[model samples]
Target: MNFISFLLFSALYTCLASRLGDRTLPELSASGITTLITTPDPIKNVDPSNPASHLSKILIPRVSDTENNTIVRDYIVSTLKALQWHVEIDEFTDKTPIGTKRFRNIIATKDPTASRRVILAAHYDSKYSATYPDDQFVGATDSAAPCAMMLDVAEALNPLLDERKKRLDEGLEDDEDVADTTLQLVFFDGEEAFVVWTATDSIYGARHLADKWASTYLSPHGKRRLMGTQSTELTGIEHLILLDLLGAPQPSLRSYFLDTAWLFDALVSVERRLGESGAFAYGEEQGMAPEKWTTYFQPRTELKINMGYIGDDHVPFLERGVPVLHLIADPFPPVWHTLKDDATALDIPTMRRWNLMLRVLMSEYLHLRPEDAQPHSAVRRDASEL
Candidate 1:
């Protein structure tokens, strides 16, 4: 997609979506400084908060501080359980003659019986080192923000789930327009490569899952076409939405067209609609504006994403033919990866709004029954308050 298309699609929201662009997409706000991310409130033990708590996990002092896969897995499992989801720990030993690293993909499902699935995913593992300073960057924005957002959604969605189950049992017909999408929250490890910039180092977890998925649904056939309503204890998969470094001060959610189609459009449309509809930004603590973006992209409208191609966890699902949508944005965000990338750069209001947007979108697309949405909505906090 070209920059113009990105601008135009957004312009469609003449009053709310597009109007902000001209005013918001100015030259620059802050100097592009290399900074480190400060560690914020650590994940403390809260049994009533998340059933995933029963799994025995430790919220590392920092993201990069994660020394091994075990800590990361425990955190994923415990956090999801606290959200009250049946957990599936998918593992693949990357042991090859070239060598292998142990990787695990944590998937906690709140309503697996739902007809279809909508996945909310982000990488929990941190890059081992940084190129800028002696500090090992704690990826609060890169992945943590998205992760925390997912956690927040889990908390708030819990109550939504109960409502869905009741309606379904009462024989609510499809005509009544109930969402039956099963919600899957996945935390991927091995997303960061051993070598920082090497194409291989970037997205190990997503690629591995794609390869495994292709083998599962396509090997029997000539090619894999990621589709179907079929569900499994550990098989059948479909669409996915990937979240990355979105917690920056004012993340510009520029829709990217250079990659997958259905997925990206659905996500961007969901984000904008929710924003304009005010469901995502409801009862704002301070009425924070949408994330401000850079004017580097073309200003047009069409069915395409922004020219910004990102290296994030969504690439794998797209490769697997799952039509994954990526929330990767433009200008790489100022606090991308520097010792200056601390929590100080984080904005709780923006994070909370995004969490609400994701919850609503996931429910809309994934068929996450209103009830299932709740069983996991506790993850969202008052952004303005934070």
Candidate 2:
């Protein structure tokens, strides 16, 4: 992912963002959020110090087409597969400035048969460097951290997703269509440019996948709830939330598109609740205690804001009319594209906060009911406000 001039495409994105509809998601009750935060401990998988943790597994020099890349990709695949997700290794070859290179995009779906899905995506490949020391760049925050967080989210929410499915099976779910929407995690490869950042070089995996899915039509089935006349894989996506440049301290995220502004706000609300509830407080310092924690998201104002989108994997799908919520840090981290972007660059507390936030956010969006370890009495915040 590289930065390009946002002026030329601002109007186009503004139009697309305006045309897309916002989803009104059910907010999790306080107990439900607590259950998600503590059930399995959100920090377990993202801890950089834990050698067997997901983040530690992915923190390697995994440039596209390299052995390290395959190792990281396989780890992601095996982790999701262990949870019984339907995993697809989208392998392909694309011509690059260097030469023809292989790329594999991991597509893991919790329920592939579902008519529609909400996607969480990130590029798993690190930027390639020729020199020995430079070649060691792991891109810890660039995406490794985000990938680990996705795994944590999957592990934390898998049971709740199962429960939602059981409820739908028993006809206890109020909205069958919404209940049918599944969670899909996409780990795109070949996101970095081989040479200079160009239209043909950057985001090779995303471009290929988007074009393929756009043309590949889905066959009709009785279980498909709202199939349009020409329903394709691309069309089946409810939204694509892409994570990039995360896992760093003091990262500032903003709403990049109007279509997903409400969705972004929903995430902000989750963070606020978690922060105020002291869910972010960790370690002996207790740095993220209720009053001490700061927000990662920049609040959206009533005034129309059109900050042109950053050039990333989501650009391909966004161009194809997919609603996107890009959760990338603005003003790229200081260690970005440097050898310093290793395990040390990642802040475990920040990653833990992200893990908790995703668990609560995705849980509520999917209408998942987490079994409360300790029940609390409070009014439900499931009212559709967005």
Candidate 3:
């Protein structure tokens, strides 16, 4: 009640408030703030044909073939591990038309500490045709090239990701709550149907993984939280970008969802810039026009056209409310699901263009800086960053 007592209480309250504010609003390190560089200039000199360059190593009879599944799985696992990524296998058995079949989803992450993720996915399975049981279909453009392209992107971004991880480990970055934007690569098995294209027959790995992720939760202490906890949310996935039928010549890619149209346009812009830099000229020998390198979903005319829904590996994620950017050819390549869809179906020039476009798009998305200037900073945790 005395004046001295009142002054003491006031001083204590002020000190407590100051400490709480310091804890909540800690000063961010300079390394934590990302600097946006010039957009899609194609200044970096990279091999244009790198995306399809791995086809020879990956092109196989059928990903679903019992004898070839392990080989394909081993290739994927070893490729990711060689890039220093943390890889995990999601193995499960599913009931199919033929019988009980085992499927595996190879999940790779660059940063394990980051809660939010950008998923780059492709199905590694080739279709099975009962009519041509003895035929060996390579499905090069259908999915083999797409899977290889995903690996190319992962390999390109590995250095930046490793640097960010180092900064986090050394305490050079002060962000604990909001880590950098991390990349998650998913190689789904059984995307192709054993019989007919039914809801249950295809995308077995994607369906299982999506369900599992939706039910899983992380606690504040980094432990597995209960599924029904009120505070739990789907914090792992931010955006899902699915690549398919990407190695065909003069392929057309259109924006699938209204939400991810901006991303599609971004890719178009990247293609245009790369064209200006003569990147697409590499395709001239193969009869691809450099002027037509842009994506099919141009804002002025093509934006209004709806290409309808596609049933790829992203279906389960999209159905569960996760944003998806389906990077598949609109009309389905001519050789799709045919015996002719082998290594010869892939166009080297088209693969080159796709490789450059993907590199620029990913660098822009992750705010990657030049290796000589400074190590790329972690993406800020703000919504605008997404």
Top TM-score model: 2
Root-mean-square deviation of candidate 3? 14.6
* Ordered list by lDDT, greatest first: 2, 3, 1
Clashing pairs in 3: none
- lDDT tens per residue, model 2, 312-377: 999888887788989999888998988888888888888888999888889888888885333322
| Comparison by lDDT, 1 against 2, better one | 2
lDDT of 2: 0.83
lDDT of all predictions, in order shown?
Answer: 0.50, 0.83, 0.64
Better of 1 and 3 by TM-score: 3
Any residue pairs clashing in model 2, and if so which? none
Q: 93-165 in candidate 1: lDDT tens per residue?
A: 6632235666777778887655445577988776555342466666656666677666655655555565666
Candidate 1: where are CA atoms >4 Å away? Answer: 1-69, 95-99, 130-134, 175-180, 217-238, 258-308, 366-386
lDDT at residue 180 of model 1 (Cα atoms): 43
The residue ranges of model 2 lying beyond 4 angstroms of the native Cα positions read: 7-20, 132-134, 225-227, 302-304, 372-386
TM values, all candidates:
0.65, 0.91, 0.76
Residue 149 of model 2 has an lDDT of 89
